[model samples]
Target: MEKIIIIGAGLVGSLQALYLAKKGHTVEVYERRNDIRKQKLVAGRSINLALSNRGWKALKRVGINTVVEKTAIPMYGRIIHDTEGNTTYQPYGLEKEAIYSVSRGGLNQLLIEEADKLENVSFFFEHRCLDIDVESNTIIFENDTREIEVKGDRIFATDGAFSAIRARLQKRDRFNYQQFYLPHGYKELTIPAGENGSFLIEKNALHIWPRGNYMLIALGNNDGSFTCTLFFPFEGEYSFESLKTEDEIDNFFKNVFPDAYELIPNLSKEYQENPTASLVTVRCEPWNYEDKVLLMGDASHAIVPFYGQGMNSGFEDCSIFDDILEDNNLDFNKAIPEFAKTRKKDADAISELALRNFIEMRDLVADESFLLRKKIEKKIFEKHPNKWMPLYSQVTFSHIPYSEALNNGLKQEKIMDKIMAKPNIESLWDSQEVEDEILSLSANA
Candidate 1:
């Protein structure tokens, strides 16, 4: 078996290590942070991730989905909170359909442990990759007091959005790269379980406090604590930059997300302590340097977390690359080229979908007209499930190509725009006339 080198022991890197190791290769996963399994904070975790069908499929391929399922909490719909603390529940799909909420740190550690079961899989903690020589396939890593150079037959860079490996490759001629950051940033907060580990709010739904320009969402953990995140603008009249003092922060939460503010007793403290992380979308061309080095996951196409596909899409990359390798007889020359070319468009599609979803989640979810549109769409979907799949369902519930989903969504959007433009659309959204219009448009789609 060929020796392989993988960078970044985050979720994608760890899962990729598991996949490659099971292929009977000597796989070394190099991570910058110390082993999370050994960390005290990793005992519980931070920012819980939403694992949809894509993520579940990848994990199941590695034979660990069952274990993951045990720790996951199923969220069948979105429980949207209005300014007055009233909630509107919107089911994500028909009965028994749901997305899962899983702890990022716990999942990563589990993946690492499972991969460690294979004697060929090894992890080098605290070894940060500094640079790489794409020509010779040699990587230099700083470990403690020394720098170590390693040469492997194949190298996979799963080192997140700001990857050290990708940074080095960006210096090459003819390489294309673009990075864009949203005006908003996210800060993670927590709502601990009640005195007896009881959920303070609805446990089976993803809770959202949609406030037009910004929003706050919460996902529950098996430990009964809810991992909450606030997506706020970095600069504005009411933004993170303006909320400087503790009073300003607390008062902001009280007036904006009163219900959530009451639930999170440590809101001000968490707001003060947690750093606000920026959201970025990364797009690049030719996610590989010939067949020697390949970039997967966020290293290639990092997207915003608005659609909750950042981790899912990255996990999907591992699965797709694995398939390409198998189909090409485990030859890097054949597999890498195909994946780089074929996966680029899908990654780009999801990036756009994610940004669009941000607006829908933060603004449209609370609008009356948007609600009417949703009701009409849902009615259409129920009547003709085969003919119409909502864009969100298509992205989250199926393995349909992201490019196809985006294209189809665009068609549906045009049709819906036409329908919504009709006079008194809000009053007649459920009328047969509206249904016929949607049916005619979707039939072509």
Candidate 2:
């Protein structure tokens, strides 16, 4: 059995530890913060995550899907509320397919607990990573009392976006790194459950209020409350910076999100009390140094949350690594570099797709053209399942590589542009001509 040292006990770290331990590795997880289960979670940081097929596959591999499922609320569609309180529902997939809303802290704690139950696994909280000796597979950490170094046969740094291990590697030669911060920032609020423990809105759907420059989204929690997030620019006419007072906060919501404004009774207080957090896209190359140390999850590629794939992608990393390990006969020397080469492209693809989705979510969801296109795509997918799948489905409902999905999505867009351009197309959206045309175009592409 190999000695594996994992940094950060967040969602990715905890899940990876479980996977490694199940593989008979002696695993030790070092976390920088206090045990999350013992502390009240900080707001804004505990953003609800969408658990999709990729994440499910990972949890199933570890045989803990049922444990996490108890806390998950399934969302089958997006419920869009317009400025005038009009609502529209768009199903995410055909029939009863749905994504799940899982609390970040809740899921992380559950995974940690499961990992702790394993004989080969150990967790150390409040142990901050100082640096790493990459060549020797050693980690230097500072505990409450003193500093210590621990060596492992292999090290996996799942330390999140701003990883200390990744920072140290950046100083070395040929380690490409770049960070892009979006102008937008996010804040959290709540739509509390009604008296007698009932949901205030449709409990099974994701609620969204999509204005041009900003949007508000709410996902259901098992406790009958909804975790609402407001995504807006840091500075603009309608932004977090511009809403300086109680009146401004009130008026902005009253005008832009009238329905949500009514649901959130303490909008003003939550607006002022909650902190606004920035969004960043982090991309780095050479996710490994030799065969001793490797980066996984947000440490290698941190993406904006618009696509709802952040946690799903990280969990998928564990699944993919497990496959690579088995394919290489449990050989770390062969698996490490192969993983870096194969996963990096998919990571970059998701990063770009997530950024693009921010625009679609914030602005295009309410557009008539966009909705019409969605209708046509859904019909096409329903009729010719073999020929076409919506980009969203390919990303969320399947385990296809993000790189292939992005390329195919672009081609599908080109074909869709032509299909939508036919005069009087909306009136004949369900016609056989449209179906044949889509199949023909897809075949040609």
Q: After superposition, how far is residue 151 of candidate 1 from its true place, in Å?
A: 0.8
TM-score of each: 0.97, 0.98
The TM-score of candidate 2 is 0.98
Give the TM-score (vs. native) of candidate 1: 0.97
Best by lDDT: 2
Q: Which pairs of residues collide in candidate 1?
A: none
Q: For model 1, what is the error of residue 350's alpha carbon versus the real structure, in angstroms, after optimal superposition? A: 0.5
Q: What is the C-alpha RMSD of each candidate to the true structure, in Å?
A: 1.3, 1.3
Per-residue accuracy of model 2 over 1-445 as CA lDDT, tens digit each:
8999999998999999999999999999999999988967653336788999999999999999999888788899999999899999999998888999988988888999999999999999999999998877778999998998999998899999999999999999999999989999999998887887789899999988988888999998777778899999999788888897999999889998898988898889988998988999999999998888889999999999999998899999999999999999999999988998899999999999999999899889999999999999998888778789999999999999999999999999999999999999879878888888889999999
Question: Of the candidates shown, which would achieve the greatest TM-score relative to the real structure?
Answer: 2
